[model samples]
Target chain A: MRRLAARVAPPTATFLAGTLLAELLIRALGVSPLLLPTPSAVARAAWSYRETLLPALASTTGAVLVGLAASVALGVLAAIALAASRWVERAFYPYAIFFQIVPIVAVAPLLVIWFGYGWRAVVAAAFIVSVFPVIANALAGLRSVDPALLDLFRLYGAGRLARLVKLELPWALPSLFTGLRVAAGLAVIGAIVGEFVGGGGLGVVVLGAMRQQRTDLVFAAILHASGLGLVLFAAVDVIGRIVLRRWHWREEIP
Target chain B: MRGSPIVGLAVLLCLVTAACSRGGPPAGRVALALNWKPEPEFGGLFEAQRTGAFRRQGLDVEITGGPGAPIVQMLAAGQMAYGIAAADEVLVARDRGADIVAVYATYQTNPQGIMVHASRGVNSLDELFAGEGGTLAVEPGLAYVKWLRKRYDLSRFQIVPYGFSIAPFLAEPRMAQQVFVTAEPIAARRQGAEPKVFLIADSGFDPYAAVVITTTQRVRERPDEVSRFVTALREGWRGYLEDPGPTNREMHARNPEMDAETFALGAVAQQPLIEDEFTRAHGLGAMSLERWRVLGEQLQELELLDQEPVAADCFAAF
Candidate 1:
């Protein structure tokens, strides 16, 4: 009971306090529902439109998960290639930076043109926006090996593959997980942007509701989108902890 | 205090009459919000402001542009005195208990339609649906698309998301897309493609566009002001049709992104549609109760509106 109370009380209290304050402030100011709907109205709307919102929420979450998985797989491989030689990094690194710099909204239309719509374009959009962080972080971890350890490996006449697999890859885990965490959030944003151009998901609901002037529904879409991002972030954090502990990665790093 | 009572009373009465003579105490300030940036689509409203027609009616009008801004929502919230939106949008708002009323309509027919390459030999909606199944780019959540799907047995066409640009349509010749009749055809022509246009209104689902709207509270509290604004708007439309050069120039100055050719073409193409037989017979910016009823029933049939709003309640008297 004490453990449950300790874990749950703070968040519940804070959320209740925030909701009460928002309700009171809006009521006092008499703000228009169009400009800003009250908390109770938003909650009611969220419940009323749960049928529509749930499916959209599921679709967005599915897109984000698929895109994030693909990004992690490609990003880690690219990072390994970069770590292998200076020439490889010089040739490919600029393109990664370019992808990051070009706004996702601008490229989304092109994705539709190339991929011909649907979740493939959405997944590709999320992958493009999210892959760079993993590449950068993994490369940094691979290259940050201790000089003394390198000397020991060389003294033992360790092969390139042996040195990489035995030492550097394990050291890269923490940095790779950090990248994954950041990419997880970005993946959801990319999915929403893709949906904005490619259609299907909470983005459609939000845009449609806004156009229709259903502010309450718009608020509901927002809540779902944020909840999706939060869940992705939290899932990445949990997986990182378990993997890092199971492999004794933390102890090996220092 | 020592002045004669008769002289004081005569002076006060003269002052009060003088104030009323200047069009009833310096007409109220009104903000008229447009859905998109300043362009030929809103030529009449822009002309009204530029030509001081609104001022003559004792109104201080502020014409503002909204790039995807919610105009009807703002009006319902009493944030603005007037706004221009599509009739369908007003119906949706009304269904949600918004007290907005459509005062006048600028477009006699909706310009929304599907455009396809002429080479594809898909001349009509039926042909496009029956043909070897290419992608149809449309905005998500468009009520018209839903209506089209339900009205015509079009199960073969694959629905793809549209990005509000003509580049995708240009690159893929066989692909069909939704477009504004006055707008995208010009863009496609610039790209060396003659798009076969199909106006959605011809399908017997015409909705008013560039509809002038205000709240019911305003209609009850200030009916005279609403009437004056609508009258000024009518004159503005006539002036715009006669010689749109000045209004076009002014709009181009405000929204330089619209190229001169496209702006000119839009101004020319829009005039005929804006002044169709109905508008010609009734005068510019004219709307009738019977027309509103027809629109209301169509919307209800489409399920765009949850319930049919009384036509009289939806539009105010001109």
Candidate 2:
């Protein structure tokens, strides 16, 4: 109970302070409600569609998880290739930069056109947004393998696969986890943006709420997205901490 | 020959109110949010504001210009006092129980027009909507997309969502021109991508671009304020039609990237539409229950009219 109270205290206190300020602002302005909505109004909007929002949350969650899983696999494979050869990263880095510069808003419509409306398009968008962080982080992790350790393993005539499993994978875990945390949030945004553009799911609800000035629903969707991002980031952090706690050598390298 | 006594009295009351003394009772400060960038399109609001006509009617007016969603959010949240939005959007919001009241019409007509790359052998509306490979630039929303999907079979065409940017149409030959008859074509000529255009409103779309809407609470609390805002807005619109003056310069100041001549041409092209008999005959901030019903019915047929209160419920006549 104390833990729960400690956890909940800050947000509750923040809300009390914020609401007091928001209400005072609204009353003082004598302005029409056509422009800036009150905090209470935003809360009400979040409440009104909590039921429908649950399903959208589920869809977003599914997209983010699937996107992260694919991103991790692709990133790990690329990191392995880059660790083996410098030429591959040099050749492919420009292509990655190209995709990075191209805004998601521009490519989303074409994805909708080619893939039609569904999770497939959402996953593609999420993947596009998520893959970069994992790749970039994993590349850094792979290259950061302690050269002295690599030399010691090479002295024992360790095979490439043995060296990777014994040394590289463990060292890369923390960086890979960091990349996962970033991917978690971005994947959610990409999925929602995909839906916002392509028209469906939680994104449509948020867009509809936005159009009609339903601050409550917008807040509700946003709250869920933020919560999901935090949860994903925390989950990755916990795993990293647990794994990193096991070895002094890995902890010392950082 | 047919003026009923009661009707005549009502007219007399209206005239008396119109001719009431110019001195204001210290009007409340009201913000007027805009639809799209400030240009010849917003001539009336600027005119009323600049001429102090709103002040005459007991209003301290602030004019803000932006797209439909943000403006509506600002208005509903009480950051703004009053605003203009698509009449259909106001109705849609009302359906969701967004307490908005449509006060008057800014454009007697909507200027949403679609254009084709003239070199693509598409010269008419029928040709533009007939087949595919040509991208149709449109506002990113359900109303227009649903209408296009329901009204016409667009299986062969690639529909590119528009962000109100002209670059897509200006650069690509295969791209169809999508613009407000008031804004985009003027932008096109400067870019040297002159395309044959089809005005949807002229063809068969009843789009009201800049509609003056107030909060329902505002209507109930200060009927007098709403009336003055409308009158002032109408007066300003009338002034804009007579002489645009530095309105283009003001618009350019808002978006320095905008070309002055292109804006002027857009105004010239738009003047014929803005000064139509609708505003001249009915009054500037007029609402057509008839047109609203038509849009509602058409939207329903398109299957895009999400369940809301009836279209008429979202609006009122002054």
Leading candidate by TM-score? 1
Instruction: Tell me each candidate's i-RMS in Å.
Output: 18.1, 14.9
Per-model lDDT: 0.80, 0.69
Native interface contacts kept by each candidate, as a fraction: 0.30, 0.10
Supply candidate 2's per-residue lDDT for A247: 82
Best model per lDDT:
1
Stretches of model 1 off by over 4 angstroms after superposition? A1-5, A20-31, A38-51, A85-95, A247-254, B1-29
Task: Give a tens-digit lDDT track for model 1, residues B138-251.
Answer: 876676887788788656666776677888888887688998877788879977997898888888877888899999989999999999999999989889988888998999
Model 2, position B302, has a per-residue lDDT of 57
Looking at model 1, the pairs that clash are none
Q: What does candidate 1's lDDT look like per residue over A225-246, in tens digits?
A: 8888888887877787777887
Tens digits of per-residue lDDT for model 2 on A1-254?
Answer: 99879978998999799888977776576433333346676667566667878887888888778877888898788778776778888887767656446677567766665665467777778888888888888888988988999999999999999999988888888788888888888888787777655545576666655554444455567778888888998888777778888783554322
The value of fnat for model 2 is: 0.10
